[model samples]
Target: MSTRNPGSLIARIGASLIVLGSASAFADEVVKIGHAAPLTGANAEWGKDTENGARLAVEEINAKGLVIGGQKVTLELDAQDDASDPRQGTQIAQKLVDDKVVAVVGHMNSGTTIPASKIYSDAGIVEISPSATNPIYTQQGFKTAYRVVATDAQQGPALADYAKKTLGAKSVAIVDDATAYGQGLANEFEKQAKVLGLTVLSHDATNDKAVDFRSILTKVKGEHPDIIMYGGMDATGGPFAKQARQLAIGARVLGGDGLCADSLAKLAGEAADNVVCSIAGMPLEKMPDGPAFEQRYEARFHQHVQLNAPFAYDAVYIIVDAMKRARSVKAADILASMPGADFVGVLGRTQFDAHGDLKQGAISLYDYKGGKQTLLTVVKM
Candidate 1:
């Protein structure tokens, strides 16, 4: 050993130190976040918008460099297509769980969100729906379920009130797509309409895929109600309104957030002017950081926000906020931290009540004029 060169031993030790430093510099953890929506069906526009929002957040966070638990972290998005089907939604939920995502933001429709919720609940993964407004979603005793938007319980009454007070409706007729969301919203609207002293003429059930609403419109026209409320998404609501106009139905069409989309004007054409709808949250233009968010989103995705982008964008930030507060990226840790979330992001202050619903939600009313969605008013709850 004495005969060996001391210089050689020093050189080997120095080389090992350099290697250790390099490894330390490159030590970064990759965290995955899951997003589910109907990326391939008629609702693909909305689904893709949701995905883009989450993806934007992930990209921005990575660029800024995130450190959690004293280690660098890179967020990855695991987006899946539910095709707006309940069964497909459950399958997607399970896949996200298997992928070990820390949090999930998605399932655009109530039908999918309700069934897929159990899967996320059993897996203990936090699911924050950006748009599913059914009250039953939070009624389930699953601590894992949460939503960012107002529920039909509030939205239905708001629309009904507007009809009675603003539109001065004495009688109303209702039509629903018969899906969970459609029927649920219609039920709430009917209950509130009764409370508001409005006469209910008739309530009709139509399939969500129904394009020809002449039969329903013919019957509704005979009722001569002042306003017609439709409980469904814009895809069907547009045609319903158009058909009502084609039949010269005198009543204006009313709908909830499901029908309050920018594409509605294009879908219904000239008939869109007869549509009045409510959104589950504040208008994007009125959000705290809405303008900036929309600008950034358009820059990144080259498309306008369809419906749930701002909510989805805020959802990712909320998940990360939980991670930072927990000082860990583990799913359980994030889940534990979600209850106390009060982060202010794109949609303004974010806080949840005992049932994991937004404590102070706001609803925006809109009407289409000349194929443009114009805001009427915002109701704070």
Candidate 2:
């Protein structure tokens, strides 16, 4: 064999040095966990809430000091902004990898979380998504991507039951924003509606930034469905409400947790009222520990509580618990240790399976009656 070129040998050594440098950099730092999400944008509210909850958890965990081996390493919080874009989420994941964070908890939207999971998996980083409810998250066979809340599978079925039993809907039309979460929930709703003895009359799809729903609402109105179940975020559902009213479609509109954000109150105005939906977490008003969280959030950020805020808080705790058990903050170690962890948290008991799916969590249905999210029912599966 010919002798290797001098430049080639230098390149190989440089690459190896870079890798070792990165490892050394991480070893010198305290335990760092990342919170990556759209911290600023239309969906920024969701990201902000998720971040706040995670920050609170990290603070509390470090305060008490998690015993790992013979040392008590203080937890650190590092945040990245994904801007609610899947591509940005991927970049953020890479950034976290470079930082060598022990775990990642963030990117509230499922569309971003789904693709980012691949990055986390490739980097051997454990990711616990607080609010990503897409079924494919776990179905992909990646043990690193974990969710703290129930998936569209449970929420769709629960909402279908509430529509049939509570709304007394004889016929229902389904619509979604064409996102992974939206489309998944819409499809699941159609399936659950059929099983719940409600006739699914029509189906429609919308874009995330679409302002008009006249065409689809018009077609759905023609179907004469008693209800329109919207499997999209409040950003779209708010506009859909106005469009549905304009179309003279008197059907009561229903959406999933994405529509339960407090922003809906201002987005849809009066049209948002009487809209029913199922949310992933108990209302801040319902949980006994909620008021305290709300107060703390208000004090820190000078803002009201965020939807699913408590869920994110609990997600960080679950990760910390795993880290303590694994006696290391490394992602693969935390991932392997997460399964079978019993963590009582802000929402409820938070546990995990080998696939990184939460074992015990409850989904609640909430109605924006008047101007507030009122807890309607709770479902645990």
Candidate 3:
């Protein structure tokens, strides 16, 4: 004992203390939330906006601090860029699963959401899409799939009804990017448009990545349709509208939520004036919590909120609400609690039906005037 080296004993004590600290820190649980969107492509603005909404929720939750299963929990967002590609969406979903994310907040487009949804379902991870509206996304019987927005089923009919009854369009020409979201919306719109007695002059197909729509516009122009409906995202929809205006086509351009963004005005320029679109949720100014949320969002993001940001924000709270209800941060527990979620969020009461679709959903129609998005009407569905 007298010959014991003091330096060695001090080093051993220091190592022991480090191990204890590490273990103490590890006691705090980290709940990883996954977000997949096109953060690097033409849809980057929307993707980043969605990510920011989730981030805001995560920050707020962490600030308040969550206690799950008697342990301090920290929420972490694992944001991934799917680039609006279905192939990349699945890859991102798998990566999130491998990383052990407890839940997912996205796969923004229906095309990406549909393919990636299977992966999340297989992994038993609950995924709530803030923006994917294709009816097929939830009809597939994936218990893990959920959405905060109205589907194309409701949105399409609303747009079609408006076009037929309000806009008094006797004939419509449809152009789709041929994506799951685009085609699904176009089909639904055509179905309802037909029922409303509007003639389907021509239904054309264009890829999502296509920029030159002169050919499509030329064909559409030849039809002399009263309204030109495009089933695609703002990235393509905006350019298509601009080209239509450049070609001097007088038909009013119409689209769904994919084209209902604040940035569309800038993207479509003067053409945006004739652009009429529909979104899956009520206008922010109309939502009970919308104005306050907008102010908070602008302060945090240093920019205006986009079409789906509020939905994304509500989705994060929905996940956290599930965690709180289940009293655990485990994925299985969250999934178990998700079905009965009745949390009142910025978008109002968030309750899911058996199909994982919002029980009370609404579609808002919009148009651009003086380079600003103006809500035309709110149609509850």
Candidate 4:
């Protein structure tokens, strides 16, 4: 009992040294991923939801004992608040680059994503948008830019098609927020609506920040159209619907992804019932792993997902998949491996084409009923 076995003592020391060495390696190797969204203002809930998704993914990845290039890698999320402003998005992009983030997962709106894409391009980092639906985001030929959702080119027509065929809208009034997303979606909707023989009464503009749209609503109400399509986010679209009702404009309201939110009803009060919107993805219930993911999300965040959280979650996993395929965490290597990736996550198949657009896109139509978003149908494009 007094004598300690020499072999046992040596083995114990070796094990202790190995544990310390691994801990040191793990502490030294950290990979940063950037997320940018409107974490303040009316859209803050959306931003927070997306950030939580990225946070959950990072936490899980780190727990898996991630290793790249023989080093134990700890993933970190560098979330920045862009406030849905274009200029601020670019600034955040540069800041993330300065911080040496390997890849980025947001900048929610097209107005923000487009300007920030150049910054990420110059920095040689990959940027994937979870919610930006403007076609120009991918059409710009930026290899570094990608989006998980469908673009306005697809989403606009789907919404317009629904208005024409389902709602049988003979004439429609178009109102846009004047932002890149709003303008682009409105343009596509207008173009398709005309093709379908739907009379386009007027196309008006509004600022995203403006709450009082009486001026525009009054002008639009005069037209007496069958529907009023507001190309904007829930923040503006909600009030737009409410004001339209207030002005006694009985036309139904329609819009693209920007207006598809659970909070739209609360924002517009009872007026949300007249709103029909399209999101450039399948319904969460339709997503392959959506149920389990939703359970995990609520358990971790202690709140219902607002929007785009699933896409953001998948975006994080996509970046990690690329890193694993390349067997390196370097941005260049990860990006090099991304072009051919076929990662499957909560969103099903996450693949991109040469233009960095989704290989297959879908549009899910929804309508507000009794203060909740009710899914109508999902159209694949």
| Backbone Cα, N, C clashes tallied per candidate | 0, 0, 0, 0
Query: Which consecutive 10 residues in model 2 have the weakest lDDT in total?
Result: 22-31
Q: Which digits, one per residue and each the tens of the lDDT, describe model 3 over residues 1-381?
A: 499999999999999999999899768688899999889988899999999989998998899988886889999999999999999999999999999999999989999999999999999999999999999999999999999999999988899999988999999999999999999999999999999999999899999999899998998888899999999999899999999999999999999999998889888999999999999998888888999989989999899998788899999999999998999889999999999899898999999999999999999998999988888999999
As a whole number from 0 to 100, the lDDT of residue 279 in candidate 2 is 77
Encode model 4's per-residue lDDT on 154-200: one tens digit a residue.
Answer: 99899899998998889999999999999999999999999999999
Candidates' C-alpha lDDT:
0.93, 0.82, 0.93, 0.91
Candidate 2 to truth, TM: 0.88
**For candidate 4, what is the lDDT?**
0.91
TM-score of each: 0.95, 0.88, 0.95, 0.93
Task: Report the alpha-carbon TM-score of model 3 versus the true structure.
Answer: 0.95
**How many pairs of residues in model 3 come into backbone collision?**
0
Displacement of the residue 26 alpha carbon in candidate 1, Å: 4.0
lDDT of 3 at 17: 100
Model 4: lDDT of residue 377: 93
TM-score of candidate 1 relative to the true fold: 0.95
* Model 2 regions more than 4 Å off: 1-29
Worst window of 10 by summed lDDT in candidate 1:
38-47
**Per-residue CA lDDT of candidate 2, range 1-381, in tens?**
878799999999999999999877555237899998788878888888778888887887777767676655778889889987888888898998899898889768898899999988888788888889988888898878888888898888888888888778889988999998899999888898898788887787888989888888878988998889998888888888877877778888888889987788788777777588887656666665778878877887787776867877878888878877888767778878877588875666677776677676567877777777677778877
Return the number of clashes found in candidate 4. Answer: 0
